[model samples]
Target: MTKGRAALLVVAAIVFLTVGFVIGQMVQAAGAIPGTAGDPLVAQSYVEKIVGETVASLQTKLDEMQAKVDDLQEEVDALSGDTGTNKGSGKTTLPQSSNPPAQGKTVVVSGDSANIRTGPGTTYAKVTTLVKGDTATMVSEENGWYKITLQDGKEGWVANWLVEVK
Candidate 1:
C-alpha cells in the first residue's frame, strides 16, 4: 500500500476505537452494563412518595393526641366542681351571725346528717342538712354554733357539736 493511504487508514481506525471506548465507558458509568438500567427520576419519585405518606401519618397522630388532651382538661374541670369565680383555697364565706364569734376559719360537717339552721340555736328554723365531708367557711361562732356558707352560697348555722374547725 502507498504510505499516505496507509497513514489515513490507521488514523480512521484509531478514531473509531476511541469513539467505541468513550461510548462503552459512558454506558458503564450510567449503570447500563450487562442487564442493568438505571432511571434516577423513577427512584426519586418513589422516595418522595414514601416521605409524603410518613409526614401525613405523623400529622394525623399529633391531631389525635391534641384532641385527647382537650378532653382530659374538660374532665378535670368538671371533677373540680369549681364555679370559676371562687379560686380561693376551696373555701366558702358566710354572712355575720347574731352572737359572739370567731373570724376567718374553715369548718366542716362533723356528723352524717347535720342540720343547717337559719339562726344559731336549736330553736332556729332548719335551712338544710349537710353530710360528713361537706366543707364550709366560718363567718362566726354564735352562742354554741358556727355560722357558715354552703357550697351553693347560702348562709346558715350548724350546732358546734355537728361542726369542727380546721
Candidate 2:
C-alpha cells in the first residue's frame, strides 16, 4: 500500500482503539464492586488509571510506528530519483545510465512543442522550447532526459521520448 494509505489506516486504527478503550472502561465502571460497599468513585478511579496507562502506551507505540513510516517514505523518495512527474518502479528493473544511441549525435525533436528544461528532468523549468523537425546537438543524457543545445545557442534538456537520434 502507499504510504499515505498506510498512514491513514494507522490513524483510523488509533481512533477505533481509543473508542473501544473508552467504551470498555465505561462498561467496567458500570459493573458492581465485589467489596468496598459498591462505591462508584473507587471503581471510576481504577478504570481511569488503567485506561490512562493503556492509552499512553498505545501513543508511544504509535509514535515509534510513525517514525518508521517516515523512514520508509524517505527511502522510497530516494529510490524514485525524486522526479515529480515520473517514478520508475524500483523493483527488479534495470538501471538506465544514458541513451546509448543518442549520445554524441544531432537529434531531431520528434514531438510537437517539446519543452526544453533547465535540467535533465521535466521537474525543471522550461528554459526554451522545440518543435517537430527542430534539430539540436545532444550534449549528454541521464534518466531519460537529454541535454541539448538549441539552434539559437540556448542549451537545455528534453525528454528522450521527444527526440529521435540522427
Candidate 3:
C-alpha cells in the first residue's frame, strides 16, 4: 500500500484499540462491587460497621474503668468516714462522727520531734514537724494516727503514740 494509506490504517487501528480498552474499563468498573478485589473503594456501610464495633469496644473498656473508679471511691468513703452521699454536690464530705474530738481540743507532742504527714500513715508525705511542747488542734483520728491542725492552719497526721491529747 501507499505510505499515506498505510499511515491512515495504523492511526485507525490505534484509535479502535483505545476505544475498546476504555469501554472495557467502564464496564468492569460499573459491575464491580466496592470493597472487593476488583474495586479499591470501600462501601460507606462497611466503614460505618467497623467504626461502630470499635466504639462499642471502647465503651466497654470505659464502663469497666468506671466500675473500678466507683469501687475505689467506695473504699475511700469508708476510710474517710464519708456517708457516700454528696447531695448532688459532686464533692465528698466527711461525716461529723469522723471528727468526734471536741471543738478546740488540742494535743501536745510528747516526743522531741514528731513528723506530721499528709495522710494518716507514715507512708504518706510529711507536711511539717512539731517539736516538744508544740500543740496542735485535733481534727480526727484514724489508724492510731491523729489528724491535727497546726497553728498555721495546716492540717497533717501524726502518730498518736507521740502526742498527748488535752
Q: Write the per-residue lDDT of candidate 3 for residues 1-166, one digit (tens) a residue.
A: 6999999999999999999999999998798687754566877667666665665466446546655666676777778788857422332333434444564689998855677888865446668777668999998777677788999999999877778888
Give every collision pair in model 2: none
Off by over 4 Å in 1: 1-101
Supply the global lDDT for candidate 2.
Answer: 0.70
Global lDDT of each candidate? 0.68, 0.70, 0.72
> Which candidate number has the best lDDT?
3
Q: How many steric overlaps are in each model, in order?
A: 0, 0, 0
**Candidate 1 vs candidate 2, lDDT winner:** 2
Choose 2 or 3, whichever is better by lDDT.
3
| CA lDDT, candidate 1, residue 10 | 96
Q: Per-residue lDDT for 12-92 in model 2, tens only? A: 999999999999999988787643436645665566556656654664465466556656766788886776343333322
TM-score of each: 0.38, 0.42, 0.39
- For residues 1-166, write the lDDT of model 1, one tens digit per residue: 5999999999999999999999999987877333322444455556555655665466446546645665565566668885656332222235444554467677887655576878865445678766667898888775577889888999998877767778
**TM-score of candidate 3 against the unseen true structure:** 0.39
